[model samples]
Target: MKVLTETWWSAAIGREKTVTVVLPPSYSPVGGPFPVLYLLHGFGGNRNTWLQCANLSAVVDSHRLVLVLPESGRAWFINDARGRRYEDYLVHEVVDHVDAAFNTVPTRDGRAVGGFSMGGAAALYQALLHGDRFSVVASNGGAFEAPLREGDPYEALRGDRNLAIPSTRDHERVWGPAGSEVRRRYDPYSLIRNRDPRHPIEVYLDIGLDDYPRMISMNRRTRDALTAGSVPHEYRERPGGHDWDFVDAGLRDLFAFTQGHLLSA
Candidate 1:
């Protein structure tokens, strides 16, 4: 596998952005094309977080797919009603740029998205709002339901003026007076709450049984909602916590589930 780092200024975010790309082992000139997986990281993480923490390239290389990890700071993959058109950035800017530049199969059936923690929410938000563009999505301990608390950590970060994050908080910086309709639009649980999930997308989520007390209730609520909505999904809880060990082990199952679906598709 080959890893590359690149940057481009995003008009949607009104600033430059960075991303890490992992090329498959069979990325040769004669190879026809490869599917793409857009991976995302949680709050307070950057493009390199997945490669550094998850070892994703090593795990998925056998499939010979391209992985793109974009750095959106802590935007939560939503266009803030106050500012910053982030939803456009991911669906339009980043996806367009990557598809045009790489030998990727640019279609809904050939694409997938997944993320950890805050990133998990972002992945689900992107796939849910743009289900026609992604065939599958996975959320690992992601805050799928607006976090069930007012002023989430991202909101608290928005409140602090002097503390500058590394990648740049476009949502907070661009959308002053954060937490509004924009945030709600990206809430996965809200999208699935009362809606019919006959949508053409498959979803999966998992949280460590020992991670948080709320996880059990949250998963149960989400599963019930999906069941009622007729949304096809897979939900599970295993022994572990919020640490990387749990996430890494869970990823094996995630990749396996996704692989099965992709093949059957």
Candidate 2:
């Protein structure tokens, strides 16, 4: 396995951002470009979070895919109301750089996105909105549902749930007001309800039994919504909490689920 960092100027976020990449053991240009998994961290984490927390390199060495972790700080991996277009920065700018410099498959069939908590939700959000860019999505202990109180923004799109924002309250700063267009745009539930079928995405999500009740309910809600929408997906429950121990325990399953779905590069 090999680890490296790549940095470049992002027009979307209008600044230079860095990402951590883990190359599979068999990595080599002559061996052909490898599939890529764009991994994300939890809230307040950076590119190094996964490595520091989990034995990521050892777990993924046999998977034969490249793992890319983006450095999105407390941004919920969405375009922030504070004028940061993290969504654009990730799907476009960072991807473009990785494809050019690294030997990656660079297409929907060979690409997938996943993450921890905030990152996990972001993975689903990015895939749901830009299905053209990825074919598989995975989340572990993900914050699928936003923490909204009574009388949040009502959904402009179809769904029983509403995500509106009245002010910049914590994550709402990144996701926008509860039901703002921006907020609705990133809501995985609403997006799944109105998913574009042309993409044919495969999804996987799991939550630890000991995780917060809100997280459990949100994951279940997401699973139910996927089932209702007839989207190809899998959901699981494990005995752990919202910590790296849980994430590390499931890395194999996550990689296998992703590997089983991605087309050969």
Candidate 3:
């Protein structure tokens, strides 16, 4: 596999962004167009997280596809009140750049999105919201649960917040304080329920058996929501914790699932 670093301008977020791309050994412009899989990184991670930790290149090498790993920082791939338009950049800017710069099948059927942890959630969330742009999604240990809930007003969090919570400040900054309208719009349950049955978005979600109780519960709730909503998806519970180990496990199979769907492109 061949890996390349790219730095480009993104007006959506009003800043430049760096992306990591991987190409299979047989990749070449002359080889014809190939499908592309876009990968997002979790909170606190940059563009290289999946490549370094998940062995993404090796796992998906045989698939003969293009892998695009774009950095999301702590933004959760959403447009926050702080003016960070990561979601917009991912759906438009990043994808546009890849398709123009690489030998890729530039269509909905040619695209797939996957991520780990916070990114996993972002992957599925973005795919659900923009099904016309992405046809398949694979989330490994995705943080599907919303950080804030209804009735939990953002104004109420002005004083004394719990520091023990994981990235509590970021959650508030990105998703906003509880009861934020964006949260409801981005809510997994609501997104799953709102999906049009006539157009199906293939989904693959998995969480470690040893993940935090909250993580496991949220993933279960999401899986149940998919089942109840009649959204086509594959769910799995594997042995591992919420680390790179868990993300790496069964990754090949997930890639295979992605490959199967990409064939139509």
Most accurate candidate by lDDT = 2
Q: What is the lDDT of residue 244 in candidate 2?
A: 81
Poorest lDDT segment (10 consecutive residues) of candidate 2: 157-166
Sum up the clashes in candidate 3: 0
After superposition, candidate 2 runs with Cα above 4 Å error:
147-168
Itemize residue pairs with steric clashes in candidate 2: 153-164, 163-178, 163-179, 164-177, 164-178, 164-179, 165-177, 165-178, 165-179
Sort by lDDT, top down from the best: 2, 3, 1
Better candidate number, 1 or 2, judged by lDDT: 2
lDDT, candidate 1, 1-265, per-residue tens: 7888767889998888877888878775355767777888776678887776565666777665678888767665667645667678888888888878788777777788888876777787788788767788887876665533443343434555633222223434433333555645655567776343444778888888876565456667777876776778999888886556667877677776666555221
C-alpha TM-scores of all predictions: 0.82, 0.90, 0.90
lDDT (Cα, tens digit) per residue for candidate 3, span 172-202: 7777777777778688888888875555788
Off by over 4 Å in 1: 151-179, 193-199, 263-265
lDDT tens per residue, model 2, 32-80: 7888999998877889888975667777787878889898776666776
lDDT values for all models = 0.70, 0.82, 0.80
Instruction: Rank candidates, TM-score, best first.
Output: 3, 2, 1
Off by over 4 Å in 3: 147-165
